[model samples]
Target: MLRVENLSKNWKEFRLKEVSFKVGSGEYFIILGPSGAGKTLLLETIAGIFKPDLGRIFLEGRDITNEPPERRGIAYIPQNYGLFMHMTAYENIAFGLKLRKFQREKIREEVEKIAGILEISDLLGRNVKKLSGGEQQRVAIARALAVKPKILLLDEPFSNLDPNLKGRLMREMKNWRKELEFTAIHVTHSFEESIVLGDRVGILINGEMKQVGEIREVFSKPENEDVAKFLGHENILEGVADGRSLNINGIRIELPQKACGKIRIVIPPESILISKNPLVTSARNNFRAIIHGIEELGAIIKLKLSIGENLLSAYLTKASFVDMNLSEGEEVFISFKATSIHIFE
Candidate 1:
């Protein structure tokens, strides 16, 4: 297992504020955050490129906070793939082993084994600078694995590839992880990647570790409005609580718990229920609104609604959207269970 306790660092205008988290043995942990949230810096700290001003780092119960990158038993793949421009793919893949002073036969066998797994064996002789983005990524990962490091670090590995190629490489990475059974801490700003590739994920914003847990839980139930908005929750509204209920722009919603005064409300787009015709139901909060706009995505449709002076967003399946025959000017009723409406103090 890898553990970081109260890690802190300061660099110019950005600083990591007492950040801490852990990855279990053979677990895939994704550090999900936006650009400049210090994702790359955190990874560098783990790889021992930068020493933390505070706290400790432990790998398998051994403290390695002061170890150099070469002695940390961690393989880091940077965002740009960081392949040497002058070297061949094979040489890049074997560089770590050469530095470790491995025998020539051992190095060749290790390089070939990883290359075969990444399916870049044919490109091993090609100049790394001339290889395509996806090819370079494979070569970089192969090089990282050649050292058989205890932990693998990937920094936005797919950001440079086209969408289709990015998707294919993600699936291939999963296959490689399963085959190699290596512990990994992959960092990316993309939530879809976190859900698909991570066993668990941690949210970092402004260099602060806001929340960490199972990937689905962290996404569905964010800890606050900041995390909610960052996770793409379309509705993060300020409201006032009155013990039993919360009111926002004259829309009163029953609360799951009792509290008073200001609060932040988070309701995901999918949590909202919309219908062309009203029906009697047990749901607590319902409102009448006019469709302000409509956006058609592939599988889902986004509808913007004007609820009094406040605007709200909701999503509907394309089939259901077609069935409703919704239009911009159409009036509809939207409701959600009080349980789905989250209020944070």
Candidate 2:
């Protein structure tokens, strides 16, 4: 288990301010944020590459704030894979064991074991520079695992990988984590990676940790407007709240809680149901909107709808779009439950 308490690090114009979180044993905790959010800096600080200006870091209840990188039982793998280009895959993996003065037989055994698990046994004798992106990634991970660190720190591990390879490697890493039972802190800007690999996630922005919780909880109910926006809530609207209702563009939407004053509401595009005909349903919000724009994104279809003076986004499957014979500038019915809305001040 790893715990960071009020860790603050200042570098140049960016400052990691009062960031705190905990990663449990065998838990894949993800630090989710956009580019330049100091994700790598935080990981480096934890790995002892940079000392924090203030606060403490504890590993299994032992304070390691002042410990050197080599003294701490943590493995850090950078975005570049950080393998020795001149060395073969086998040598790269065995480098750590060699530096630690492991016996020749033990180094060979560890390197082979990790390579087999990562499915890179065939490329072990090949030079790292000659391997593909995914292969090099496996080699880097093998090197990290060969040391058997208590905790693993991964900084944008799959950033350089292509889409297909990214998905495959994510799945492979999940299985490997289960088999290895290693506690890991993975930092990434990609939502798909966080959703697939993280048991829980910490939202970081502008060098601050805004929220941290289970993946579903954090995504479904973001702590603030910034967090909500980062989670891909494309339909953010400001409205006046009067008791249990909201008034936006002369349209009244029922709310799950009674709130007053101005507030912001986030309606997930997937939550809005679109139909050519109005159906008798329990949803409190229903309106006739014009489809002003339609975008085809692979298997998903995004529709920009106009209701009165307000615009909203809705997503549908490609099959459903074709089934309805929908087109741009056409009129349609949109409905959503009051409870599906996320409201914040």
Candidate 3:
């Protein structure tokens, strides 16, 4: 297990403030945040590249906050793959073992084994500078695994790859983790990647660690308005609470049982339903509104609705838009179940 408690670091422009989290053995934890949120800095700190001004780091159960990078037993792969340009793929992967003064035979054997697992055996003889982005990334991963570190930290490993290649490499990484049983902490801004690759996720914003939990829980029930907006909750309705209910722009919205106080309701654009007229359905919280605008976003249409001085965004299929004859300046009714409304105090 890897534990970080009150990890704080300061740079010229940004500071990481009392950040803390835990990753269990063999667990895949993703550190998610926007660009320049100090995600990479935290990873580097945990890997012993930067000493934290405050806080402790523990691997398994041993405190290693003051340890050198070499003694930390952690492998960090940076965004650029950070392989030696002058070395061949094989040599690059074997560098860690060679640095430890391992026997030539053992180094070669370990390098080949990891290369095969990462499906880069054929590229082993190629110079690192000549390999493609994906191949170089694989070589970097292979090099990290060659050391057999206690934990692996990947910093935006897929940001440079194309979408298709990113998907394939992500799948390969999952398989490699299962085969090696190595605990990993991956950092990325892509929600799709976080959902697909992470066993759990930690959200960081403005250098502050906001929330950490299982993927589903974090997405469905964020801890605050900032986290909700960061997780793609584009339609946020601010309202006052009045005993198990909220009043937003004259619309009474039932809360989720114990909800109270001034709350921000996060309704995902995809969770909203639209109709030309208020239909009698099982859904709760139906309201009539006007179509403020229509945005054609490829295969999907984004409808902007004017609901009592507030604007709500909803995504709909192009087919549904055409069938409903949705147009700007037209009257419509939007309905969303109370369960779909995520409230944060």
For candidate 3, the per-residue lDDT at 151 reads 95
* Model 1 per-residue lDDT tens digits across residues 21-116: 999999999999988899899999999999999989999999999999888899999999899889999999999999999999999999999999
Write candidate 2's Cα lDDT for 139-199 as tens digits: 9999998999999999999999999999999999999998989999999998999999999
Question: lDDT at 339 for candidate 1?
Answer: 82
Off by over 4 Å in 3: 258-261
Q: How many steric clashes between backbone atoms does each model show?
A: 0, 0, 0
What's the alpha carbon RMSD for model 3? Answer: 1.6
Which candidate comes out best when scored by lDDT? 2
Q: What is the TM-score of each candidate against the true structure?
A: 0.95, 0.95, 0.95
Q: What root-mean-square deviation over C-alphas does model 2 reach?
A: 1.6
CA displacement after TM-score superposition, residue 301 of candidate 1 (Å): 1.4
Clashes of 3: 0
